[model samples]
Target: MGVVTSIIHKKINEEENTILFFGRILEYKGIDYLIKAEPLISEKIPNIKIIIAGSGDFSKYESMINHKNHFEIINEYIPDEKVSELFQKSSVVVLPYIEASQTGIIPIAYAFKKPVVATDVGSLSEVIVDGVTGFIVPPRDSKLLADSLLNILLNKNLKNSMGSAAYEFMKENMSWKGIAQKTIGEYQKLLGNFEKPRYLIGSLQ
Candidate 1:
């Protein structure tokens, strides 16, 4: 997937017009955090839009977000094909998850060469280098998230540099070809020696 995204991004050349958040709409995905951060971000960059791509019971969450200006909610499960469209349209991708393992979403963002702003929890920091690929704010810190988002939006050069670095990193390390080759090597090392089982499942005398 990462390999595919990298190739697609290289073919397109256009400026971004929005920011996108992709994932489940559960409480832990930190939609609430983003909602709170939006107002602060909008104050500085009014034209910047935050596009929420995923569905959940957003009634409570909606109230928290400042819907007065720059926000759009696509409260539905985004299909795989349309994900690229979302990525292409957005300036940056944010993964403000409270808890996570290795996220597939991060790779997708990298593949698209879109800079990310993620909370420093789980394996997110491992993937995103602060000030290189994107900024990693402490989890649950809406102020930091807002600040980081604002910084990336306001500075076009920083955004482009980070996006370029992310794309290069993904191409070299995170591709399916790279993963499969490494996995095969590991399996071969483990299965190098041949042995016959001495015991039988059933014996008859």
Candidate 2:
């Protein structure tokens, strides 16, 4: 997953207490957990604003979003070009996934140099370096998730530092060029001992 490298690192409408969930709305995506965690988060961080930006049937999650004043849902498809805008404006990106392989959102948030709060499921724990780049809480635990978000949102210095670290991690490890090179290296190692098929070469010639 590659980010728009052209989008320079500069603060764009950065709100210190804004948390975002940017992706498709689905049950497994754990938007419900995030919504459930909101009351707990708001109890601690009163000024917190949660922006749920994605396209889906948000009506299913209506009951969980008890704190409507603190939660704003843009229940429509976010255009590819406009994705960066949401990433840039928020203080932190949240992926409270109950089950996940990986998500493009994590790297995109890293590209924007925003800290993340994600659930400890699938590759999320591996991607987010807890207390370094972002926080990873136990899956389906709204309380723990809220605690993690509150921790980051409450501390400005920690939030900024984590965001910076996230950007560095993305540049060093998650860039598409690096991933491609690694894939190529693995292929080369695997194929180095194989003899070229003479018939295929002759056909090409």
Candidate 3:
């Protein structure tokens, strides 16, 4: 993994300020708004690298980019073997989705101990504890998205704090043991009597 990671580092030109826009580049993923936020993000970070890694038709989005030099686009299906290397290389993960049902990206980012900056849509926000795990901005609002990215990129301490929290959140909340405990707690709290929830599981309404 280290050898491959080194190769990826070269591909990224060793840019640590890189924000990754990963996953399938579909319309609902809102790559357009990311292009719109390019200038705003560059005004502050300057040498920022926005790495778009995933399989999709990118010609349409290629023309929309302003600072063409600042982007590192890999418009192809990233293999599972390389996925860890890619995430480990990123400073932050971004999901500028305009529409979503749910996403598994948040947990994946957290697992890598990387902070995420995603837009509020569907169940995305429900996962991110804004300003704690990561920042959640309004969907389709490029400025807010850019601002959140800037916030994470500019402050190293804040970024580290958020990343650590993100990992912990996933470790504790998304795990089977944690989920079971939380679920039982919720049931107990709802009943206010520590009663068994056997009857509540559609056995008796």
Candidate 4:
């Protein structure tokens, strides 16, 4: 996922676009919310383009986005290799999940140093610090989501600043190497504190 975001970031940078979103096409993902907010966002930035990748049942939300032609919907299960291709083709990666326990997708956005606009649900807030790495809004609020998205898209300085901060955060904390070392240290401590059982030699004799 990180690799994909990096690719998308590179490409979008070349095109000078502002934002993007990548992930599965699940109902819980809040595509409906994004679709609903499209017109509101477009009222501000008419050129704003939202690229949605990954396949799922979007028939219900299709009508919602029909009038707003600024969105590009890739309605197919993007393969692992193709993920980077998609990511490289866009700007910011949005994750508006209604429920989550720590998302693997967040790390990918961090990897590309792409600023995020995720809902303040579950562990998402823990991952994305509002106004720092990215903005976090109340879940199911399309207006707030649209506002955040517009803010990032319109403000290049803020977008770059947040992206840099996000990248630094990932480098300092979320890397696989750092996680492995921390996990190993915890295991070692647990093993060192483990007690050994004593045998009842007198009873056996």
Candidate 5:
């Protein structure tokens, strides 16, 4: 399916040194591991804030996180307008999924040019380019996850560069326009519209 291409990019909130986890809070989502990593990450980047924006039973791991003070848990459904706000405010977006088939968060983060720190599981590896658009760590490894997030948050230049690359990747490969063209190509092939396919390829060139 083609990604929704109607988003308008917002300027990054440069003043806030924030990391975000914006989605459902579930066991498979691995928010517990992310929370565990917060303290380790905070040790290196003391002032960095972690925003866990979603609705779920956060009390399950509330006592386990070492650096609870550094986190802001918005334990409710995030509204449409607020989605952009959260993405814009954060320096990095994290997906610490223990298991997943696919995720819509990466493309959404790409729209804001926000670099991601996701676990390597299922299709997440296909979406994230390690050391390029973002970093992918092994699932449930809080230390490695923290290190990857720290690497992005501590270095502003790297964050900005990766974010820019993320956006470019979205525009080039995942944009609805590109997806529509591919769909059209398939349809044309089925219909034996050879001349139109040539025209399409030529125009792209």
Candidate 6:
């Protein structure tokens, strides 16, 4: 599902240490936290490239970006074609949302075999197994967010391990078949009927 490396990310120049914070830009998405974490991350890995892509007015965030030279901001709609390339070039995907109902970004990152660093918001915690698929930090905590991102960026084995786990998690849990199976299991447990229903059977579809 990966596209050949493209100019969008090659322009970052340092793909290995790159962290992606992509998706629609909005106040509740906590771009500020990622910005605050930059200096903290730079203190350890100096040449890190942080790519912030998606549509919205980014001018409001100008004041927060202290490491301006290290950041590549795409403050307009990104085409569907280029998304996979962006994910492929990134070492980790970060979700620093202060508030969120849910997000589809984590699965996309996993599909690229990329690990995620997300804040505890909405259903993100349910999908991202902390320290396994990715690390889950507290919302709006820049230091912890920085720490989690640094963990994946600095450790190659851990990053790959987590990314692989994330991909498997997505594959096994996100599939309709898996969902239906789990649903059937839950019904059996709820009704205390572990035995297969022979007399009265029903189809899930």
Superposition error at 6 for model 6 (Å): 18
Q: Compute the lDDT of residue 135 as modeled in candidate 3.
A: 97
**How many pairs collide in each candidate, listed in order?**
0, 0, 0, 7, 0, 0
Query: On a 0 to 100 scale, what is the lDDT of residue 193 in model 5?
Result: 50
2 against 4, candidate with superior TM-score:
2
Q: Give the alpha carbon lDDT tens digit for every residue of 1-205 in model 1.
A: 5445433533434445487898778888988898888888877876778888887777778668656467788888776666767787788999888887768787888888889999988888998989999989998989999999888889999999999999887776688777788898889987886444556434432
* Candidate number with the higher TM-score (3 or 6): 6
Where does candidate 1 have its weakest 10-residue lDDT segment?
5-14
Q: Compared with the true structure, what per-residue lDDT tens digits does model 4 show for residues 60-159?
A: 7777775556877778887765676555555677888888777777777777777889998888888887899989988899999999988887888998
Worst 10 residues of 4 by lDDT: 6-15
Deviation from native of the Cα of residue 174 in model 5, angstroms: 1.8
Residue 144 in candidate 4, Cα distance off native in Å: 0.7
Error of model 1, residue 134, in angstroms = 1.0
TM-score for model 3?
Answer: 0.83
At residue 114, candidate 5 shows an lDDT of 89
Q: How many clashes show up in model 3?
A: 0
lDDT of each: 0.81, 0.86, 0.85, 0.76, 0.85, 0.85
Give one digit per residue, the lDDT tens place, for model 5 in 1-205.
Answer: 1433333335445445798999988889998898888888878878978899998888887887676679888999887667877888888999999999999899989888889999999999998889999999999999999999988888889999999999988887678886788898899888885456665887888
lDDT of 6 by residue, 1-205 (tens): 2222232342332278999999988999999989999999999998999999999878899998887988999888888666867887889999999998888788788777789999898989999999999999999899999999998888999999998998888777865666788999899888885565665556532
Candidate 4: segments with Cα more than 4 A from true spot:
1-14, 184-205
How far does residue 186 in candidate 5 sit from its true spot (Å)?
A: 5.9
Looking at model 5, the pairs that clash are none
Minimum summed lDDT over a 10-residue window in model 5 is located at 1-10
